[model samples]
Target: MSVSGDKIRHRYDRLAPWFDSLEGFLEGLIFRRLRKRLWAQVQGEHVLEVGVGTGKNFAFYPDRARMTAIDFSPKMLEQAKRKRERKQLDVHLDLMDVQSLAYADNSFDTVIASFVFCSVPQPRKGLKEIYRVLKPGGQLLLLEHVLSSNKMMAKLMNLLNPLMVRLVGANINRQTVKNVQACPFKSILVDPTSSDMIKLIRAVK
Candidate 1:
């Protein structure tokens, strides 16, 4: 990794604690609806989540599905471990990077990412891996914050993105949905949130 990327990663390691704390609030207020919507499309299968911060989606997954979640922050993964301690579930949480995943090609039946595309050092490379690691016909479920088509909002996000990434380890101006659709997968469902900040999309590869 470059020096800048290394520095950015160290920043995330430091912020993991605060990020972990917000998982509950985020899950209750935001992810609940998004997860419920995507859960119907992907269930009872071998599932993998990239950038699986604090394992927020672990509970949302159906009981029958075997879930393996990977994240770059060890501290974040440790917090996730604590959260799952009481729930006897089939979930394996790993501290791993997204740009270079260790899993084999076509290793999973489904792949999910929730609000994760923003901070990845190379979002396109990570998406390609998400594509390669999925079994044929496997679904890719994504809940992403994206660049708005609204000119005013887009301009605002572009202005804030660099500072946001520096302070919060997040990018506010990523074209996450467009990047995902650029792959070979056929987009089966795309439900854009009315306000346009987030979108729930499911694609079949």
Candidate 2:
């Protein structure tokens, strides 16, 4: 891994134990609805879920979908494994980086990424990799926070990005929707959520 990737990995390693606690309150208040919106639109059998932090989305997945969930942080993956075991979910968990996927081209029927692109050191590279792995006409479902279209909120996100990254390994100002649109996908659809800071995206490959 590159220096930046190593840094992000180390940061998540430290945060792994308490990461769920941090997200727990918000999950019910805000995130669950967005997750529902994203997962409800998903269609496919073979699925790959990137950034499967603590396996929080495990319950939302349809029982019929075969899942492979990956995360760059081993510690985070460990926590996710516990969740998988507890829930008895049929998910294959791997420690993998999004920028360089291990699978062959056109491997997955569907891809999912929730709050993932923000922390990737090379968001475009990661996006491209997701594009590469999807079978033709397959879908990529995403629930993510992005740089707000509102100028003042955008400025606020830009201002907090550095601090947020240092604190939690996430960038607050990534224009992920734009990055998704720029990839080799056949089409892209986006729906605003959480005051336009979060989005539900469906990109066909």
Candidate 3:
């Protein structure tokens, strides 16, 4: 069976045209605290956002900073470009993969991701690439839905994730903290529960 990642990507590609509607529906339903936390990390020189769905975090990026964003699906990237064009924001957008990126090592000052880790095929390889692409002391910021501490919820997630991922590129339960810890980056963890259901992490290479 093909992994859920491609299916999820395809789902997003199909949904790209109505993405803003989905974003509108998900606005208040999304993670605010983690969003703010990760946004604050967007203040550096060269900011790289992976899985930058529709350029949602572009506004939070420091106005003076250069922004480069990538996604696996061209359809998603197209919507993202349209969004950027509407905003008149000069953002570099591309169709790229997280696990194997084209950027050279130590190229970016800050690497950012939001709501994206769960679908990546090889999480460790992605992290290694993230580490390699970031300059020393450069930070990695992430805001994501993660596995819950509640055992019952965790159990349910373990069972239903495969099916849920089939319909969307994201899973309800990804242990992003464990993945961060295993990466070379020095991780700082913050778990804030409100509406967003997120894991806010800032790690340095």
Candidate 4:
């Protein structure tokens, strides 16, 4: 991993124990429903979930889908492993970075990420790695909070982003849709789940 990647991993490692508690209220009020909606559209047998933080999405995993989930933070993955054991979900969890995936090219039929790209050191590199691992016609599903299109809100987010990153290791001002579009995905469809900031993106390779 790069220096920036190590920093992000260490930040999340420290945050792992308090992560669910910190985001509990928001998760209940908004993210839980959005997660279900995102996972419902998952297709194909082989699925790769990037950034499986605390295994929050384990409840939504398709029964027949072969799930292989990866995360860069070992502490976070430890939490996820415990959750997977308790839930008895058949998921293969690995410690891996999205910017440099260990999987072979065209190995997975579907790739999923939830609010993850914001922390990635090189977002485009990670997107390209996803593109490389996905089979032709494969789908990439993302649930992300991005920079608001509103000028004032966007400016405010940009101003606050550095502090946000320092505090939580996530940027609040990423234009995730544009980043996905710049990749080689054949089609991109975006739906605003919570105003224009939080989006559900579906892109095809």
Candidate 5:
């Protein structure tokens, strides 16, 4: 892992135990519905979930699809494992970094990421890895928070980004949609699901 990756791991390790509590109110009010809707749109037999924090999306994954989920932080992976057992979800979990995935090329039919790129030190590297592991004609499904398109909101996010990263290991000002567009995917569908800040992206590999 890179130095930044190490820092992220440490921060999230410390945050892991209470991460769900931190997002509970927001998840109950909004993100839970968005996650379900996003997960429902995925269509594939084999799925790989990158940054599968706390396995919150585990409940929404289709039973027909085989699933593998990974995160770089060990503590987060531990929490995710607990979630998997508690929910009785048949998911394989890994302590893996997105920028250096262990899977073979063209290994999976689908890849899912939720609110992940913002914290990755090298977001494009991670995206490229996701693209490489996906089978031809496979899909990359994402539910992400990105830099707002509105100027004032964008400025505010930019200002708060550093503190957000330092405190919670997440950046609030990433232009993840643009990063996805710049990747080598064959096709892209990008939609702002919430005020041009949160987005749902589907990219064909």
Candidate 6:
């Protein structure tokens, strides 16, 4: 892992215990519905979920799909493991980095990420790894809070980004759609699900 990756992992490890509680309000008011909508589009039986922090999406996972969820933080994965068992969800949780996926090429039929990429040390590299692992015609689904298109809001996000990263290991200003477009995905579609900042991005490999 890069120095930035190491720092992010450590920061998230430290934040693991309080992770769900910290975002509980937003999860209840907004994220839960978005997560269900994102998972509802699952295309096939094999699926991979990146950045499965504390298994927030575990409750929405498709029962028919074989799920493999990965994260770089061990403490976070531990929390996720407990959630998995508590929920009685059949998910494979692993301590892994998105920028360096261990799976073979064309391994999964669908790849899911929610509120992830903003914290990735090398977002494009991680997207490329996702592209490499997805089977041909497979889909990538992402629900991310991105840099706002509104100039004033974007400037504010950029100003706050550094502090956010320091505190939570995530950047508040990231052009996630543009990063997805830069990858070799066959097609890309983006929907602004929350104002113009949070988006539901879909791409095909």
Assess every candidate by TM-score: 0.89, 0.95, 0.90, 0.97, 0.96, 0.96
lDDT of 1 by residue, 1-205 (tens): 1225566677777877877565678767876787777666675379898877766677677777788898887777887888788666668888887778899998899898888888787888888888889898888888888889899989999988888887877888888777877878865567744348787878887
Q: Candidate 5, clashing residue pairs? A: none
Clashing pairs in 2: none
- lDDT of the candidates, in the order given: 0.78, 0.87, 0.79, 0.93, 0.89, 0.91
Please give the ranking of all candidate structures by TM-score, highest first, separated by commas: 4, 6, 5, 2, 3, 1
lDDT of 2 by residue, 108-140 (tens): 999998888888999889999999999999989
Model 1 poorest ten-residue lDDT run: 1-10
Better of 2 and 3 by TM-score: 2
RMSD of each: 2.4, 1.9, 2.3, 1.8, 1.8, 1.7
> Which stretches in model 2 have alpha-carbon errors above 4 Å?
1-3, 192-194
Residue by residue across 93-117, what tens digits does model 6's lDDT show?
Answer: 8889999999999999999999999
Task: Tell me the spans in candidate 6 whose CA falls farther than 4 Å from its real position.
Answer: 1-3, 192-194
How many Å off is the CA of 138 in candidate 1?
0.5
Q: In candidate 6, list every pair of residues with a backbone clash.
A: none
The segments of candidate 3 whose C-alpha lies over 4 angstroms from its true place after superposition are: 1-5, 191-197
Better of 3 and 6 by lDDT: 6
Give model 5 RMSD, 1 decimal: 1.8
Better candidate number, 2 or 4, judged by TM-score: 4
Model 5 lDDT per residue over 1-205, tens place: 1238888889999999999999999999989988987898888899999999888888888899999999999999999998888898899999999999999999999899899998899999999999999999999999998888889988888888888888878888888888998899999998544558888999998
